[model samples]
Target: MPKPNKLLIVLAFFSIYVIWGSTYVLNKTAVAELPPFMLAAIRFLTAGVLIFIIAAVTGQNLKISRKQLINTGIAGFLFLAFGNGIVVWALKFVDSGFAALEISAQPLVILLLMWLIQGKKIKPMSLIGVFLGIIGIYLLVNQRQVLNQDDSYIGIIMIFFCMISWAYGSIFVGKADMPSNYFVNTGYQMITGGCMLVLLSLIFNEEWSSPLVWSPNVQLSMILLIIFGSIVAFTSFNYLLKMVSPEKVATNTYVNPIIALFLGWYFLDETVTLQSIIAAVILLSGVYFINTSKRKVMLNRFGLQQIQNKLRKNKVQ
Candidate 1:
């Protein structure tokens, strides 16, 4: 196999870091003017269609086995439908800044779910990281403060559900049987989930025309979502996933909250409190430790020593 280009890898990492980081702010703006589910549906629908058309023109096979289609649809429902849908809905009541903070707790949720469902063992230090992340989330939620505020508690709960749904979706996607054409697979999933969202929007009787005066802002955010979040970020993420370890690719989650926080502050005049700063530090630290835990660096060190000793014994004997 040809050696992968280091430059391309670097570029992929940069794109994933920046593009994904900006999506939360974009989502916040989109939801501010659009019916959350309808906005999500439109975003994914346009993105998915454009991607599929491009793939077709490029002569990529869009066909999949029945099993593959089913799996893809299932993943779409979990990840985009529930995961992203709840996020869009939560933005209605939560400040984008606080919403970003809540979403940053996802890494810890994923870790705990992996342990429970897959019977994976976590390292001691990483377990501390999980606890710290939980504390950060507790601070972010501010149940005492939010309970008295109108609809704040409900929004917080919705964001928490968003986190859990995303965690579950990530796991499901990992286990799913994917198609050979990754781009096509992604397109299908987005299209499927987007359609589901549209159906849901109708069921909830969310008036699509309610935010007519906010059209310009909503349109701009939608365009950004389709171009940056769906197209650019997804392509960068898949490229990184193929070229690097999954753990390394997952680092975008940590990077995204930082970008979201800054963008929310700059564009939305969102305040960053001491608690937010503390939460950001603790959250990033927790994500770092949790990601590294998967590698079991401490255990690997012992394994390496054991291998060296075995080699020495063979030589001596």
Candidate 2:
């Protein structure tokens, strides 16, 4: 196989790591001023439209079978509508940094779900990682300050659900039929998910009466979310998935929380207590263990065969 492009990999990493991390802060800011469902709906709808236009202009095939459309729609609803939308709503009660940290436990949750729902065998190290993750979560949630507030616990619970929804959606996407063009597939997902958010907003009667309600900060955040957060970062991630090993691409999960914590503290003046710092370390360490263990399993199972197949394919090409 040919060597990968170092520069493109770096750019893709930057997009997914930095851009996605910063989005937590942006989402927090926007949801503070705008209704969460409405804000998410508009951001995704605008991004979806922009991406769809780009796909069309670039002559990418937009066609999909009915099965592909259904699967894509389901994945979109699970990922965006429940995963992201709930996190945005929960941000009203949670700090952006804390939310990011909590979401970083997604891999562990996914592992557990696969084990329980799919009957996948869990490696010993991965089981340990799961236990550690639970401890970290307990540490974070049981802090004296959090314990004193009912709403904080509510937000934390909501974020937990968000992680589960996101992980399930991610796992589903791997098995489900989708358009061959990643950009077109992403566009459809965004459009379908955005429509779901809009429907929820309407059902809930979210306040959208006046333009004056949206502050300049909220407007700017929304625009950034649509462009950088949704379109650029997501496209970069898709590119990376094709060009690099999934293990390398998964490093973004490690980097993003750190970036989110720093940005939240620097810009938002969010609290970063000693307990929170310790919790972050434990949570991230657990995630590290989980990922490394899973990588080992994957390599043991398919690494050699896949490499041989790839080499043969390259020769044919």
Candidate 3:
């Protein structure tokens, strides 16, 4: 097999960052018309089938051991069932920017989980970053205009729970014995999780007929969700998770929120306040610290005084 190109890796990274970021606005648009769970089910199911067909043609084996299947199911439950499902529902009541603020805390959640479960210590700088992230969240949540716009405290709270679900899902994926083939594992998870979501929509008796009432704009957004958000973004993310550190992969959490914020502003006429800018900067800086601090430590241990030192030297030369 030919080695993967570096450019391809870079493109995948960018794709996940940009595409997933846009999902917040997309979700808001979609749920304006479609039931949240039903939308998620349809998105993932369609993505799963498309990928499955591609896999078949490419001769990618769909077979997985029982243990791997279980792990995939668990990941699906955590990631899709709760992480995504709850966020979609939350959008019915919250602004896309606010939703982005809440979910952007995934890095902090990952850090705390690592400390509690893996016996890892948080570095002081990283701790400062966490503090800043909290401050950012505070600014965002307390914004007076934002509060007046929707005033659904319950929806904000729901997004927090969604953050927790995503955090847990990320930790589970970090520890699970996943299959070697990234696409296969992703496909299995999406299929299982998507089925569960469909079942849930039925159990809740959510009116599937509501979709017919959606505006053409909402319909277009759903198409984007399935094609770009579900299929392209997820596949890129799973591929990166296999190729890079989980910490590195989760950096998208930070990047995505910024993209979502901008998209929300441009498309939804969502206002971006001074507070929003403050919060976004702090949150992303915290994510940077949390994700990269450990790498700096490891590099120091190996006698690399500065991780960026070589790059600087190369540029100077």
**Candidate lDDT (C-alpha), each:** 0.78, 0.82, 0.81
Task: Name the weakest run of 10 consecutive residues (lDDT summed) in model 1.
Answer: 238-247
Off by over 4 Å in 2: 1-10, 209-213, 238-251, 301-317
Error of 2 at 311 (Å): 16
- TM-score computed on alpha carbons, candidate 3: 0.89
Candidate 1 segments whose C-alpha is farther than 4 A from its true place: 1-9, 143-148, 210-214, 238-247, 296-317
TM-score of each: 0.87, 0.88, 0.89
Cα deviation at 276, candidate 1, in Å, is 1.2
Question: Candidate 1 overall Cα lDDT vs. reference?
Answer: 0.78
lDDT of 3 by residue, 25-79 (tens): 9889888878889999988887788878889999998888999999989888888
lDDT pick, better of 2 and 3: 2
Candidate closer to the true structure by lDDT (higher is better), 1 or 2: 2
Better of 1 and 3 by TM-score: 3
By TM-score: ranked, best first: 3, 2, 1
Backbone clashes in model 2, listed as residue pairs: none
* Arranged by lDDT, best first: 2, 3, 1
Q: For all the candidates, what are their Cα RMSDs to the real structure? A: 3.5, 3.9, 5.0
